[model samples]
Target chain A: MFGKKRVAIVGAGVTLFRRNLKETGKELSYEAAKTALEVAGLELRDIKSVVMGSAPDAFDGVHMKGEYLADGAGAYHKPYTRVFVGGGTGVFTPLAGWWHVASGQFDTCLVVCEEKMSSCYPHPQYAFTTIFDPILERPIGMNLIWIFALEMNRYMHKHNIKKEDIALVSVKNKRNALDNPIAQLAANITVEDVLNSEIMAWPVQRLDVSPTSDGAAAVVLASEDVAKEVTDNPVWIDGVGWCIDSTHWTDRDLYYPDYVECAAKMAYKMAGIKNPPKEIDLAEPYDPFDYKELHHMEGLLLCKKGEAPKLTREGVTQRDGDLPTCPSGGLLGCGNPIAAAGLMKVCEIFWQLRGEAGKRQIPGDPRTGVAQAWGDLMQYGSVIVLRR
Target chain B: MRYYQSEAVETKDIKEGKIPTEKFRPKAKFAWSAGIAISRFLEELKNGKIIATTCSKCGRIMVPPRIYCEKCFKPADGWKYVKDTGVINTFSVSFLAADASRLKEPIVVAIINLDGASEGMGIVHRIEEYGDWREVKIGMKVKAVWKPPEERTGAITDIAYFKPIRE
Candidate 1:
């Protein structure tokens, strides 16, 4: 899709997602970067540029987090840039690296994403309080869950969707996580278990939420010539797109994500996907919450508006289903370290595409897939399409 | 292919200082300006009235007034006093606080679309005077329960909470 040089992902790596990891964010970044380099059969000297993606500095309790993480991301005295778009940093980081290679500016670029939510005192959720407007929303004493609860409630009301339908997403994802070695919340749970779980807010139950976690993920991107030289089976980055809605989230209807649809449309146009459900063999939309998977699927144009829940009910999104979704178990089952979790979805797509997923691999030899993330006051969407 | 590795630490490790952790409590606070449009809105609240901004371009009556109309990208034309009464667009019975602490009493939060404001323009506030959240619904009519004029500051809390207009 590039005039100068097509970009391809040669290697990818992910660290274990957990509540508290002894490794610092830099150390985690180094571990993932080292693994990706090793897998790509490339050395630090071979990398011409570096890209880092991390969420708010408040979570890490460190300012200028990009500069702080440079050495760890293997950017010592090299051209390095950091990407932050709330939770979209993960997939977005690789897109930045793609620009470097696709523009023919660099032969190879190393992309790393890391988050250490465990560093925050008391709880990580406290850092999110600062995300709201101090003049209006902050004074109301909003917990992060409140926004999701409000959106979930509105979504349910608008579509006349049942809680039973939403709970199925949690059940499917958690069960899918059982096969993933690095997954944190992989469990054999039921829709009843989700409904009976402790309610954080009226509509959001404990099981509906993804836990705060610490981890890192990395990937190696190279130009077409370099990709063929380094690896025989390189997964090409077919398309990339991102879009942000107005910061005034309250004024807009929260029933569905218009931004995600805009982003997917941009990507689909680039990938030449006229019909998403028919052309895209796999999907890994962000699933920080159970219903979000359905929300994002519709946003990605994988199904009709409000038709995602019905597909989930019919088991169409299962790993073995016609259209496999979140075969990595997603953030709902896997831990969510914000930026790192998004990159993990990209890594999952790379693995599934190359037939390296082992137990989590789908039966069919899927050739095309998309990974997407939503972030920032529920106003941002980042998407990437990969093909073998 | 071999992949993924990390060491998990327990809470006691940090509490006992076994993990070599440094504790931080941020004191870098700021007194943010209420800006041009909201400064007047907050001032009106001090006088026990709710104010909104009207955009001549898009013709939107926006609550929590902004200097510019987001849709048309033009300056707002004028201001008007919106009624303190509205309908609940959406709400949640939150059992947890900002710090992830379980609250002794669950808070009922709602986004209320003010009566003189344009459609879909809502301000977030608390829902009160109801015994249970089950009594609340998306379309329930509500009115702002303002604090006494003397107790009011030019802040969002001037209206203590929104209660049911019916009961």
Candidate 2:
């Protein structure tokens, strides 16, 4: 949508998604950022600006985490900024970098996202409790799973959907993750396995959720001229959109995500996409929870409302399916490092478009893809459209 | 860039002191002001009543009251007491606590849209199980089971939990 310089992702890099990584958050950022620069054939001196995306500071047990992670992200002498939109920070990071280059103020930008959820004592889920409203929601002693379970129950009850139907998403995504070398919780499981798994919250079993992980991902954004010089197959950022709804999530119906639809429509309009189910080759809708994939698919307008579960059941969302979704195994298959997980989706789009996603690649020659992330009490959505 | 992978560490390694680690648990605390809107709301709750702020222009009543209407962007008309009863908007049966610890008695949490509040304006609270957990369903009517007035505090917990209201 920018009339100035166009922005393109020249290279993408990510560390192995794992439950516990030996490296600190900064070290993980350095590892990912170094590889991104190396793949782009650019040095630290070439980066004009840097954008770092990290979720809550509670996860890393470090306050002012942006400044703490800045140097490692190669922002030594460059203009640096950090974006935090809860889990959507990953995709939003590159969107910020895209603007840095598209505004014609910078020729190249380095975007990195990192999350060290393992650093949170007891469990990373404990860090999530702080996200609730202190005066209203927090006093009730709620965990993160409660909200997801409540929403899942509402969605299931509304659609008359069976738990087995939702479990298939976990089965498919985990199976897909087996092909990804960096995937953490990748496994060959079935709907039965997911259904029989330990119940955390009713309707949300152990397998229904993505693992909390420590990892980092990075991508290099460059102006049109710089992109042409850096790589032969640069993935162009066609459009970016983000939206946030009311902070009082309890006041709204949980069956559908109107915020996600708003953000997707904005991005699609900017990308000149009128029919997403046909025009978009594939997609990476956020799937921290298995049912969320279906929720976001409808939000992305990839299918009719309440049709995504049916599509998943029919193998339409499979890697080999018509509208391959989350072919990188998604958050369920790939480990979910929060911010890193969202950026990982963006990186997957870059790899899939360039034919570099070895075994996880969709068979058909896919050109256009959309990566979306939802966060912050189910109120925020970030969407990015990319093309080869 | 080739053959790059992150180093994975085992939690047992850190637990067994194989990995040198520094642990610090800070007591981070804060005293939040209830402010004008919430202070009155809390006082009403202590009196076994649920109060909401009404917007004169939009005719919207907001629970967990706010001084100004979000839609109208004006001072709310005044405070109004809503019914302690509400419908279960959505709920969850949790076997874990805030610290992620397994609990002996599972907590049934729900968002209740108070009877007199505008549509979608609700407060999150715990649901007390009357009998079978299976009996709980969405759209079930519920009423606040308040603590004794002497035991009541000016907080959300003043109403112990919401139980299903039987005909």
* Structural similarity to truth (TM-score) of each candidate: 0.98, 0.98
True contacts kept of 1: 0.79
**DockQ, all candidates in order:** 0.79, 0.68
Which one wins on lDDT? 1
**Which 10-residue window of candidate 2 chain A scores lowest in summed lDDT?**
A1-10
- Candidate 1 displacement at residue A351 in angstroms: 0.6
TM-score of 1: 0.98
Report lDDT per candidate: 0.92, 0.90
Error of 2 at A365 (Å): 0.8
Predicted candidate 1 versus true structure: per-residue lDDT over A248-319, tens digit per residue: 877878889999999889888888889999999899999999989999999999998889999999999999
> Tens digit of lDDT per residue, candidate 2, span B81-166?
89999999888888889988988777898989889999867889999955777789989999999999999888999999999999
Please give, for residues A233-321, the per-residue lDDT of candidate 2 as tens digits: 99999989999987878778889999889989988888899999999999999999999999999999999888888999999999999
